[model samples]
Target: MSPFVIAITLSAAVLHAVWNAIVKTAVDRTTTLGLVAFGHVLPATVMVLLLPLPNAESFFYILLSTVVHFGYFFMLGKAYQHGDLSVVYPIARGIVPALVSLWALILLGEVLPAQAWIGIAVIALGIQLSSWKVLRSGVGKAALGFAVGTGFCISIYSVVDGIGVRLSGNTLSYWAWGAFLHIFIAGFIGLRKRATLAALPLRVWALGIAGGLVSMTAYGLVLYAKNFAPLGAVSALRETSVIFAALIGLVFLREGNWKRRLGAAVLMAMGVALIGTSA
Candidate 1:
């Protein structure tokens, strides 16, 4: 990958971690997520209004992604309610790349290096280790499981959107429509829970909006990176969010389950090193 694309991937990693931290720390994960979803629409809707719709062929795929992303947000909200960032974030974020690598091999004709496969496993195993305490702690384990499953759904949409946007040959247009639809769908669900959304404090709104914009920017940069790099590499690089998320948890939330956390960090570092070498 070029320095430029690598830069985008790393930048997206930061934004992704930051936004997730906001969600994890929310008073009500579901309501905060709803606001985030609702917030995302303003930008997405504006883009949809300004840009041409994706061609008919890719439109269905975009719709599919939108549906899956809803599940992602819902589950993520539930997960945050139950678990601390240290545990839930690793489970939700780390597991995706390995799945995505397998998906890329089957769907996109991308072959990852042997070393990267080991890296992927190390990353996953590290996360698995990190989660042991949470599993024993009895806080939102079910919610964490749901969030992890939802993250798998998120992985599917990301790969689909990545491929669909590329096939459309207009990256921004597809992203705008797909992203806008995602936000619109989530916002509608939240509006259905109007009381919860209305009660969100200004502080939450401020943080949520900031997080949303960061997330949107990250998505744009990652999609742009996908244009040039293998999906697997991009996927692995994006998982760097796990490292950042761990730090966020330790510093802000004080989720200092250190034995498990140190192991998780080691696994993430191994993954990053392996990926860097392969590049």
Candidate 2:
């Protein structure tokens, strides 16, 4: 991959961690998640109006992605309810690089160099190391299940959008449409929490929507990167967010085990360097 694509993917990783931190800190994860979808809807609605529609060939992938996202948001909220951001986030993100690589190989006929595969393995190891404490202390079974499920959802969408955007012939249009479909997500959540949403403070609303904006931008960057790079490489790069999430968990959220998490972050960074140079 070019340095430009690597830069944007890495940037997206940071933003992705920040938004997840926002959700972790929310008073109501479900409502906050709903508002995050709403945030995506607001900008996507405007962009769709201004931009040309993505190709019809890509529409099926877009719809599939939207369905997948519903599961993703639901599982993510449940996982956070059951566990810490540091633990849940890494486990949830850890499995995606290999999963996406396998999917890309089967569905997209994409292959990576040996070095890239090694980088992926190292990143996966780092993710486990980052969450090693959970092994000793024992994360909730519910959290473990939900986090793994969330990782599956993320991998599916990443590949789906990777294929969709390439077929769309326009990254922004694909992104806008993909995000706009979250209206269903936001609307569903809104109706379910109509009373709670009404009672929420403006500050909560602002934060949730802001998180959504950050989420949108982060995915947008990833989508753009996908257009130029192989799906596996892009995914491995994007999952560097797991490391960032670990740091955020330690510093901002006051989660424990600084030494292990920091060491894992370093390993993940090295994996990132390997992928960057090899790609």
Candidate 3:
């Protein structure tokens, strides 16, 4: 990856971690997620009106990505319900890059060099290391299962959106449409939890929507980076967000065991350097 692409991806990682921290702090994960979806749709709706439409060929990929994203969100909510941010977040983010790389190799025929593979492994190991205490103590089976499911959904959508944006010929247009499609999720969740949705204070709504915007921008950066780099490598670099999330949890949420998490972050940073150099 070029330095420019690496910078963008790393920035996205920070933003991604920030938004997830917001969601993790919310009282109702599903309702907060719905608001986040609304946050995505609100801006996306305006952009869609102003931007050119994506090509017809890209629609199928866009739809596929949207469907996969729904699954991802649902699984994420379930994971959060059963585990702490530090525990669920690492496992969920940790598994995605490897899965994405495997999918890219098998389906997209994109084979990465040895150094890139080593970087991915190191990053994955660091992610696991950050969660070692939680894993050793046993994050409830339910959380582990849902988080693993979330990882699979993330990989599916990453590959789908990578191809989708390239086919659209206009990165912003594809991003806008993808964001707008989250409205379906927002609507569904809103309808299902009308009482909860309606009862949320304005402050909570603001936080949720802000979280949505951050999440949208984060993914948008990744989609743009995908245009210039291999999907697997880009995905692995993006998983550095796990390290960011750990730091956010420690500093902001006042979570414990900072020494181990910091060490994990250092290892992850080294892996990120390796991947950037290899690129």
Q: Pick the candidate with the highest TM-score.
A: 2
Which residue runs does candidate 2 get wrong by more than 4 Å? none
Best by lDDT: 2
For 1-279, candidate 1 gives per-residue lDDT tens digits of: 888888889889889989899888877767667666666667887888888776777887788888888878877777777777777777777777777878888998888888988888788777768776656776566866875886698689778877877776677788787777756666666777788768777898777777777777888888888888877778778878878888888888888676678568668767855764575
- Tell me the TM-score of each prediction against the true structure: 0.92, 0.95, 0.94
Alpha-carbon local distance difference test for all models: 0.77, 0.90, 0.87
- Ranking of all predicted structures according to TM-score, beginning with the best and ending with the worst: 2, 3, 1
Sort all candidates by lDDT, best to worst. 2, 3, 1
Alpha-carbon shift of residue 55 in model 1 (angstroms): 3.5
Lowest summed lDDT over 10 consecutive residues: which window, candidate 2? Answer: 270-279
List candidate 3 segments past 4 Å from native: 133-139
Weakest lDDT window of 10 consecutive positions for candidate 3: 270-279
Give me the overall lDDT of model 2: 0.90
Number of clashing residue pairs, candidate 1? 0
Which of candidates 1 and 3 is the stronger one according to TM-score?
Answer: 3
